[model samples]
Target chain A: MSNPKEHLYQKTAFDLVSGFKNKQWKAAEIAESFLNRALDTNKKLNSFICIPHESILDHATLLDEKRNSNEDLGSLACSPIAIKDILCTSGISTTCGSKILQNFTPYYDATVVEKLKDKDALIFGKTNLDEFAMGSSNENSFFGPVRNPWNLDCVAGGSSGGSAAAVAGQQCAASLGSDTGGSIRLPASFCGVVGVKPSYGRVSRFGLIAFASSLDQVGVFTKDVRDSALLLRIISGQDSKDSTSSSNFVPHFLDSLSIKKKWRIGLPKEYFQQGLDSEVRQALSQSISLLGKNKFEIEEVSLPHSDLSIAAYYLIATGEASSNLSRFDGVRYGYRASNPKNLNDLYKRTRSDGFGYEVKRRIMLGTFALSSGYYDAYYKKASQVRTLIIQDFQKAFEKVDLLLTPTAPFTAFKIGEKTKDPIQMYLTDIYTTAVNLAGLPALSMPCGFDSKKLPIGLQLIAPRFEEERMFQMAHYLEKEFHVQNSKHHIVL
Target chain B: MKFDIQTVERIAELSRLEFDAQEKEILLQDLSKILHYVEKLEAVDVEKIQPTYNIIESECFFREDQISVHLSNDSLFKNAPEVQEHFVQVPQMIASHE
Candidate 1:
């Protein structure tokens, strides 16, 4: 009835798979549609760093031929999924949005990339991100800032900003983003998409370029809650390569979506108490009331140490980042300094020239924290407070099935709004950081829009390894909120 | 604590980074402000709590000790600034040449 291009470009990945299964369209046709859309708008949005046209079409053509011959098709038979540049794809550059690894191509796929391919999903392209997932906005990217599709003057939140913008712009049906602190959810909230930060160790981190080893987790951004669940089910499972990946059985996440049991949602008193935008607060409270009307119990809970989350998180993340990022010296691989006089110059020049401002700042902050006399005063104290933050969540979950909060303090600010003030930028993820510090699962979905028409994100966090419950609650919330089809209306 | 230029320079040296004079001045102020903000952690009274460096309960996972195929020299040297036969070349380590 409508122009088929609209449906083709905007269909949920689930429907697209169903469309392919019915022989309604060839895999090549679907892949071509997405590639064309991505190419059409990437310049305006700056959502992608590189789009390998030849490789993507070649893979799609092979998939079409196999489909025509009636071969076994995987879940994402023809679906095109965008990966944040941080994920390593074999033979493609995994830059982690830094100049140091600009030309470095990986020889093997990350565990998640392998899983996506195993399910026959097309590797859409590498999306831009904050360099090494450091900054809260995508402006830190070496490529450029990822403009929010809804309002080009505004920024798409980072470090998964490019992935969020790509999904928001209809460049891809869905995408993968990484959340260290609020990387995925912050951007998703800004771009009006569903982003999930799965429980730590729930998904293997074998090939995710480590930001903060303990806090970094791979997550998905999609048009709807169900696609988030589908991707989670596919990518999660124990990988022997990632020693931290849980050996527990990966639960049937998609199957849990149909179970419509009402949940007891906790509204953290601290989250609502301060620094929340009035409009954003109004929308989150509306979503909570809608849940209460739908028979879900709502109760006020306390995370007393919540105010200290940002401080502790920055210390721990940078300390871990300092240790994790030390491997990128001149000799091994990636960008090496041009002409160093000696070994020390080689190390100094390579790192100084290779890393950007925010990366250097964090590395130094971490070095200071972990340095000789300061270790007990800084890093050690922060880690101990980290224990209290974890215990707070553990205790809160005993009272409620999930805790709800705003994914970020405000909607997408204008480009360069918070860049000059690093503290202002860091405060954007205040509510989301504590979840990562505690190692929990959370999701951000479009609840409503602010006065500027930029989307507001509602965050729902669950206990560790309880992603099934997280998905169940988010699925129910989305249905109740009736915010259906609030996706991909990019101005470009 | 005041993060003076000397402290910034020392920390940068420890981090194996060498910033220009202007950048160092900016970093001194930025790091001082950020560190001042992070001073909130010291007030949390972490007297008896044990630091949690990891979340997973599993001890060090032991994979079978097996020699297998690793990355070939070509891929390993692919991004090297300078490469010799199957090896990455770098500047001389000692202060004086041999």
Candidate 2:
């Protein structure tokens, strides 16, 4: 019998699925092992807000029965995956990390959840997130901040902080996260994992609690690139429930990963500006050099409007957030205030009591930006600037096959450092937010570590429908950077 | 224009939120700074530019809407704070004209 601890805890999704296929481990044994490890680690990491103990074991027994009979199985048959609370799971509490929806149990699974279950993946528990996916740090979560696995003093990036921390700390094989701005990539970077934010429309947003409807995209956090690609292939596709979902055929991302890289990659000058820490910049430069030696050409490109991305992102994101959140009126669903005398009172008291401070702040800013007299002056004009930012990426893509940038300006800071200053918190997304505005696909891979041994991510971005090219480059860099097995390499 | 106390209160009311006296004072100052920065937008010439919303521009793609089984009324009201006759109860809408 295998020493089931590490195998159960931190095995990559790819390895686990392959093992399950060969009947090397029974599904029940695998599920129990992970559940045990998750329960043990969650105490320190606070990565999981809910763990579906009884249901997961029940599902495992069924999968083990199917395996013993030699029945054909789905892709993720018996593999464990955690979901950020933002995605609704049928019969499970889908809080979106807000008190407003604390008691709300979704009657239907989101399209993504339905697909995951159809593939036979175990629905692990819901993870914590910023209330409504608003904050860059997980501290804004109503359940309490999720601690970074790499260092307990630091924070796991948010609003997908719980998912990233869970995956990083061996709580799950893979976890799904939503990235409206940098929620997915930021946490993935800080937690030292592979995160891919698929192109807008790649994944269905049918039941995800909306943050910025246009910008919000669901992504995955995995211990390895191949696992990320596998999860991406499964979750992506058009859906009738989501209008923005692309009708295009879902690419065979696993097959795409096999394609060799023989193209030019651009490093944006604006991303490597003065504020970037020298160590992080060096890590990116070294990665570029490694790629150069491997026959991939690298060049310096300019995205002049890049500096305005943070401002424009905040305006556009908050403006849409304001509009999307208006549905929580304490009338149709979710929380209702205690003895609300009137409709307006119900709306006010419910929202005031349900939402957290950061959520309230964004809603206010968004409402102000989109208000009648200021619409043209703020929202519309910010959109034009957003267009300019998109053009910057478009113009650069013409000259290079892909664009490269640091995933974040600096490495993850200590918890409570940025809590007081909201602007500084927003600034953490400086590099990752631009891609959301442009509707492009991007991935954040671990590039280097800072002086304190925290991970820094180098972002790889590609043009529309060019995720294949982006993956090819990422695979090459994964080898070139020599970052493999450097952090959290499970030897079991 | 910079937002005064009255403007702030009005916007707060419009947003269905409450702002205390100190918060209103702070909001006034913050709004002034933001408005000053956002004033750059006025210089842009958008006379002929139509506002662009929904960049993807997809038509509604519905499922086979042949009564594809709706949620049970019990499940719908399971989390409701107030329910009456299998329907969610809310405060009556008091019309201004009425």
Highest DockQ model number: 1
lDDT scores of the candidates, listed in order? 0.89, 0.84
lDDT of 1 by residue, A233-314 (tens): 9999888789989877888888888646677889889998768899999998888877777778899999999999999999
| DockQ for each numbered candidate | 0.79, 0.46
Candidate 2's C-alpha runs over 4 A off are A1-5, A482-492, B25-51, B57-63, B92-98
What TM-score does chain A reach in every model?
Answer: 0.98, 0.97
Q: What is model 2's native contact fraction?
A: 0.37
Can you write out model 2's per-residue Cα lDDT over A283-359, one digit (the tens) per residue?
A: 88887887777677788999987777777788789899988988887887788888887888888888878787777
Q: Could you give the C-alpha RMSD of every candidate to the true structure, in order shown?
A: 1.6, 2.6
Candidate 2: what lDDT? 0.84
Per-model TM against the reference: 0.97, 0.95
Cα deviation of A383, candidate 1, in Å: 0.3
